[model samples]
Target: MSAPWLADAVVLAHLAFILFVMFGGLLVLRWPRLAWLHLPAAAWGVAVEWTGWICPLTPLENALRERAGQQAYGGDFVQHYIMPLIYPDGLTRHTQLVLGALVLLLNVTVYAALWRRRGGRRG
Candidate 1:
């Protein structure tokens, strides 16, 4: 595959992963086994945001862009792409912390509901 195509694929995959990390815990409600996959993913997502670490995908995408004869962009994937669409003001450390907290809050709420529905038992 060409570098441009590969870069686009990476961007799409990154978006999907973000969505999954943000909401995949809800899937555990229907498939208990999913918790094994989603719990760790959610934690990793939270950790990445809280620690202000750029995801590995960002560099891969940037490299792909360069290989495609395109200019490499600065900042993480969000700043280069998602931020332009949703957060015109740009991303900041505070925003990253908020994103981390949001991830934690949403997952906790979903897991709490799951726990309550499961008779307060650990699943």
Candidate 2:
């Protein structure tokens, strides 16, 4: 495939991953086995936001864009793509922290519901 195509694919994959990280707990509610995969992804997502670490995918996407003779962007994927839609002012450190907390809160709430559904028993 062409470099531009590859770059587009990476962007789509990154977006899908972000969605999964944000809401994968709901999937886990249906398929408990998926938690094994999702828990780590969710943690990594939270870590990326909290620690201000750029996800590896960001650099990969940038490299692909560069290879495609396109202008590569600065900052993480969320800053480059998502923040513009949600926060026109742009993404700040405080906003990242709040996003991390929100993700954690949403996941915890989902898992808590799952636990209650399972009778509060541990496996």
lDDT of all predictions, in order shown?
A: 0.91, 0.95
Score candidate 1 by TM-score against the native.
Answer: 0.94
Q: Which residue pairs come into collision in candidate 1?
A: none
Q: By summed lDDT, which 10 consecutive residues of candidate 2 come out lowest?
A: 114-123
Query: What lDDT would candidate 1 get against the real structure?
Result: 0.91
Off by over 4 Å in 1: none
**lDDT at 87 for candidate 2?**
99
lDDT, candidate 1, residue 50?
A: 89
Candidate 2 lDDT tens digits, 6-106:
99999999999999999999999999889999999999999999999999999998999899899999999999999999999999999999999999999
Error of 1 at 45 (Å): 0.9
Name the Cα RMSD for model 2.
1.0
lDDT of 1 by residue, 12-119 (tens): 999999999998988888987899999999998999988988899999999999999998888887777877887899998998899899999999999999888989
Per-candidate TM-scores read 0.94, 0.97
Which numbered prediction scores highest in lDDT against the true structure? 2
